[model samples]
Target chain A: MNFDEIYSSKLALVEDALKKLMERHKECPPTLFKAMNYSLFAGGKRIRPVLLLSAHELVGGNVEESMALACGLEMIHTYSLIHDDLPAMDDDDLRRGMPTNHKVFGEGMAILAGDALLNLAYEVFLENAMKYPYKLERHVRAAFVIARAAGLHGMIGGQVADLEQEGKDVQPDMLYYIHTHKTGALIEAAVRAGAILEPIEGDVEDAVAKYGQKLGLAFQIVDDILDVTGDAASMGKNPSRDEARKKPLFQLCMAWGNRGVWHGT
Target chain B: MNFDEIYSSKLALVEDALKKLMERHKECPPTLFKAMNYSLFAGGKRIRPVLLLSAHELVGGNVEESMALACGLEMIHTYSLIHDDLPAMDDDDLRRGMPTNHKVFGEGMAILAGDALLNLAYEVFLENAMKYPYKLERHVRAAFVIARAAGLHGMIGGQVADLEQEGKDVQPDMLYYIHTHKTGALIEAAVRAGAILEPIEGDVEDAVAKYGQKLGLAFQIVDDILDVTGDAASMGKNPSRDEARKKPLFQLCMAWGNRGVWHGT
Candidate 1:
């Protein structure tokens, strides 16, 4: 399939998976589950899980094997986003063209939603492991990859660095480290996870991982570019908020020296 | 060995393991490493890791294997404590006897320290998996146990519930759920992980898990009791802070309705 078609197809699968997952949580407290589903169902690119699925496909892995893994990655990504938007974190009021989780659900409920999502992510992964017909080795490897990506060395590490650099002129090396670990780590794990499941070896796994790494960084850079140039409506939130906060984006742009990059917003 | 002597010896071993882990981070920024070590070294009971080691001994598992697992558990625990004390989370000024991480280090550094410790925990586990002379299955199973305990279903779930109930009167069932999931999950995992490594089953494993569950709950309840009656200096922090903040503890105690019962602090 062409890129657009492929992306659309992958997203459809993700939407279906998410629908099933959210439905499972309905037996939980109604308001709490609704708030959880609100941010989860809120639109995003589903890039990490898609990367996982696509990489699995490329490696001749069964889509069945990847389905839960994809969903788990998305759960984690979504949870992080929810937490990141908390008043204690990014304090964003809008995301993906709608109110942020805390904005709609209140901070307390939003926090629970994020917590439930994080918990459910692992539960889903464990459930997948129990169901998968594969050897225990593959499941273990997958767990390690997912954990590393989600934990400090990968996404959380990046977040820590990113938070540290807030409102400061960060070095280029620090910026790269932040982006690679924080954003790229999860993306890389998505691709690598697929490869691991399929038992791909040698250069193929490495190549896919590299692709993910590059794409993740490119994605962040595009976000930066968009924050500078894209319309608030198109971007789904306030475009100038990052600038107003004097976040590291300004330092990154200055390092790139890209003035007048946007003619219109 | 008696419990006191064994505890002291295990503490020494844990200290060594923590020292080695901190040494690995020396190449990173000193401020970041120092903050990470500060929390790691800050004296807590080391209950989770100690339980793991004791369970391993009870099962006749290798001490080295148990030690590795214990170290990993401690790292996860320490990191969670650091994050838990953040201005956005509990906003505590003290943990154990020392200033909370964010108080000594800025909020940003404290955040990164937690992140780094979390990553290092996983790294240590991965290394153990690689080095184990036993079958990969055992290591993988152990790793899964740790991940499950540390991840959303375990500690993170409890944290979310605790945060959700902040400034609210929580029912006994809700309080039980929070404390069990938060504190009990990891403790149970510690015991179970040691058993998993040794390849035991039947009532033995179940008994160990049950013991851990009860012990974990008992520990938390005792902590609650301490907060109400313990000396601040002896406890190493403000014991009454929980009550002052109108946290869920008072509600929990009232729900239990054991005002006459006293567990020695």
Candidate 2:
């Protein structure tokens, strides 16, 4: 299949798997279920899961075999967005052309919904890993990669740095740290996890990880550019959000005269 | 060892492991690390971790071997507390004789701190489980139990139910649902996880799980009673807080004339 066809096919698998997961949770408290469903079903490109499936497929792994894990990655991504848009965090009222989760469900339920999504991500990972006893070790390792990327040392760590840098004269190195940890870590992890889940050679795994890292950094820069130039109609949220909040951006850092060094890194 | 001696010794192991985990994260952002450590090390009885270690011991597992998983359970418990005390939730200011996480760290940091703790809990679990390749299946099972107990079908489900019932006339069945899911699920999960981590027989696991379920219910009942009857000096929180919020409690449910049926269930 060509890139678009491959991407569409993989996206379909992820969407189907996520639907099944949600159907299983239909009996949960109505508000929590609805809130989680609202944000999860919100339109966004399934980049992380697509990256994971692409890497896995490149290594001759079956897309169906790792579909649950791809869905788990998407759940984690959705949960992070839900929490980030909370009144306490970025405080955005819109996401992907819809009112934020808290706007419709209330703040308390929003918090619980985020918590439930994060927990269920692990539940999905563990449940899927358990299905293949013979490949249990690699599965555990893949889950570990995802966990590390999502935890304090990775995405959350970067978030802390970013949150602390709000309205401050952020340094170039700090900006790099924030972007890498917050965005690059998980993207790199998705690719690495895919390689680890299959019987891949070490060099190939390293190459894929490097590719993911570069892609992640570029992705963040594009996001920063879009936030400055895009409009609400296309972006589905206010474009001036980061600038309004004085949230640090890669473009701001690049203007600080470290562009060459950053590109080298 | 006698019960007290065994409990004290297991407590020491868990405490030591937790300390090491904190020390490892000292290089992370200072505020996040401090926020996480503040509540994690706050003076409170280590019930969940203690239960996990004890259950593991009862099933002939070594305390030292399962120490990390026990600590992970404690982290999950701590994260739940941090989130529960948010202004939008229970709105408590004090916990275990100190300012709550959000009270000291601000709501935004407090939210991130809680999210980090929950993520780290899974990191700890997956990391520890990966250590024993020969026994990987059981370890995965143990982590799965913890994940399920903490997820929508377990603790978070209960929390949603409780949140929805605030200031309302709650039914006994609804109260039962809240108590069992919010409080009892993790307690029972700790015991079940302990048993699963070892090579225990199936009947023993069932018996231990049943014991955990009863203990979890009794524990909630005692907590409700304490909320009404205990002093601030003892309980380390405002005694009337739950009552003021009109929180659904076991005692209130009992007063609804389902005491006999509740006990039988």
lDDT, candidate 2, residue A17?
82
Please identify model 2 stretches exceeding 4 Å from their true place.
Answer: A242-265, B244-265
Q: Which digits, one per residue and each the tens of the lDDT, describe model 1 over residues A180-201? A: 7778889989999888886676
Q: Clashes in model 2: which pairs? A: none
Off by over 4 Å in 1: A22-36, A87-89, A105-127, A130-134, A240-265, B25-32, B87-89, B108-127, B130-134, B149-154, B167-171, B242-265
Best by TM-score: 2
| Candidate 2, true inter-chain contacts retained | 0.85
Q: Which candidate tops DockQ? A: 2
Count clashing residue pairs in model 1: 0
Q: Can you list the residue pairs that collide in candidate 1?
A: none
Model 2 CA lDDT for position B78: 94
Give TM-scores of the second chain, every candidate. Answer: 0.90, 0.92
